[model samples]
Target: MRCEAAPSATSPPAEPAAVFTQFVVKLYSRCNFGCPDCYVYEHRDRGWAAQPLVMSPAVMRRLSGRIAEHLRSHRPERAQVILHGGEPLLAGPPVLERFARRLRADCQGLTTRVDLLVQTNASRLDRAFLETFRRYGITVGVSLDGTAESHDRRRPDRAGRGTHAEVARALTLLRAPRYRPLYGGLLCVVDLEADPVETYEALLAHEPPAVDLLLPHATWHFPPPRPPDGGEAPYGRWLAALFDRWFDAPRRETALRLFDSLLDLYLGGTSTSEMWGPYGSDVVVIQPSGLIEYNDVLKTVSAEAARSALHIGAHNFDRAAADPGFAAERAGLAGLCAQCRSCPVVDICGGGLRAHRHSPDNGFDNPSCYCADLSFLIGHVRERLTHGVSMLRARFVQGRWSA
Candidate 1:
């Protein structure tokens, strides 16, 4: 049975057509940590090695101009500029401040809201860096894999030393009364081997406002690790266990983005993140050298999968929107495979992340490697929600009859 290509019952209101709303600017091309699972460093893409170590003043100026032009042309109600890296902090406070100030000045009076954010490994976040972030109103999102043992296993420093202590210290600072407002949240890549409940407990220790659990970037060509003894859907079971723990907690301490998205979908609401739903792609990335590209996760698919002829030095946002890769992402569900079109949860999963469906044999015309897991998790959430609603309805009737 083929599912029709219609908006989900929970789909959000349509957004205005815009060239792009999120600009991910790569401030530096080198990272301080050597995370084994980093799509940029450990994946097939080696393009980063050839780029300039840091974004130059001239390139930043050009980027600012291009972004301002894009905003003025499209006039999206709001926009966000994300400072990404090899470690955005590696660019130092002075450089980052200049970039932020330039972008804000250029877009002044154009965008209704301008948000600034920095995604960091958090090891280098000290008092000085926090002050700079505060001055610019840039929220800090830290990447830490659960507990020390689980985190240090994959994320290490250049000298091969465990960075858990440094990350922990940074987390402490981020959660401090003064800096807590700047703490955006925690982003943890799932380590299948780690115990889900223990990992959840460890992450909650820092009291992050939210947590985003990400599936490690993988494609059909280089798939994620399989379960032992050919067991089916290990990742699905793992996520489900974590969902139960989060749902059953006496009080919801922190927002788990994945579970929250799933629950929202099941309850007839659209997803807010690119990881799910039928939201059109509204993000564009700028390399340190001024090249325009799709999402960085495309690096995991192939070395050149993310490479585009569009260069911010020459092309404006309109030219980038014309790029075939960008067009494909903008196409949304129309770009999904037939298998996805036939799936019952097509509205919820949105054919998974585009990069995860890649293969040498069929390009991206395939469902994600995590398809089974997504289906299982979504179904589990829907069932639980349906049962809960039924129970509430029954109690309401019983109370009326007794009265």
Candidate 2:
């Protein structure tokens, strides 16, 4: 996963073996509710429509075998399997149990530690599913946008009704002391229109151990929305506001991945997530029909970009990683465009998300459309860290003098 450069695109060279630490497996291809913001269904990816509603028994066994082979060969320090979907709960508890059992049965002897999780919208979350997850040692993560009003505006049922109440009801169950052990945290997409402070406070109501704040998926071809004021670096300003609230807190209320990673990278430490930093990508995706693909976020560019011809039945994980696009994705600094590579804060933004760099003219060889936003956000964060560190040093000196 940590490679300095990619194999040549046209001629290519033999690639060293890669150890994939994270795998996103699609359990279901369709959702009971319609969330217009979904990257899979609402985006350019119409391929999901043709996939089986639930992964077939054959595909499950085959995919598990491939993963077992990977674990045995690579023996990575840790491995993660994220059960994903149009709505993974739609696959039902029975199917999920079997899937988990199959994975455990196949890789029982492997030395690698495995973390099993499910990311769902929580409309179908209940005790029945919770029991199965708890029994199998699977943690759960729910997608809940800010509060009821903002959440409903972006994510709603097919009938155009709000889902915050229903989702919150499920969260109440997941938050029980017994179930809190399985709480994986909340995933909230950034809402520019909503007051940043208000949105952060609203999400705090859930008492989640962690919070994943993501910029809505966008590319140069389709830039993300800006506020009514049309301010420069709007997303950066929004994130900075959120960062101040989280950073200035008396105690660490929750783990915010975006800010946490930024702070770490600024202080000369490695980031934990592939979404940030120039670290090589060690993540892969298994589509509903057994397609072994690259970044699913690339579906925002084009469905085909996220997909490949490799299948679990025909190709092993190694073969899948050998794909040119796969290598290009994990290319680190070499993956960046001339523009991004020249930027002063390129390391801070890491050229932004690869999907955000996509364009028809140059393919994946462009700076993120959020370039200005990233520069602004990262610069602001660096300033705050510098100021905070200086004050800490001064406080220590003052304490010593008093003593």
Candidate 1's displacement at residue 147, Å, is: 0.9
Candidate 2 per-residue lDDT over residues 1-403, each given as its tens digit: 3355665688556556776778999999888677776788888879987888899989999999999899888798889999998799988999999999999888898999888999999999999999999888999999989989999988888898999999999999999988999999999998888888898998899999999888889988877887679589998899899999999999999999988888888878988765568866878999878988888898999868888888888998888777887888888888898987888877777888899888889888898888888888888988998899899999999999999
lDDT against the true structure, per candidate, is: 0.87, 0.87
Q: C-alpha displacement of 41 in model 1, angstroms?
A: 0.8
User: What lDDT would candidate 2 get against the real structure?
Assistant: 0.87
The 10 consecutive residues of candidate 2 with the worst lDDT sum are 1-10
Candidate 1 overall Cα lDDT vs. reference?
0.87
Candidate 2 colliding pairs: none
Please identify model 2 stretches exceeding 4 Å from their true place: 1-16
The Cα RMSD in angstroms, rounded to one decimal, for candidate 1 relative to the true structure is 5.7
The RMSD of every model to the true structure, in order and in angstroms, is 5.7, 3.7
**Number of clashes recorded per candidate:** 0, 0
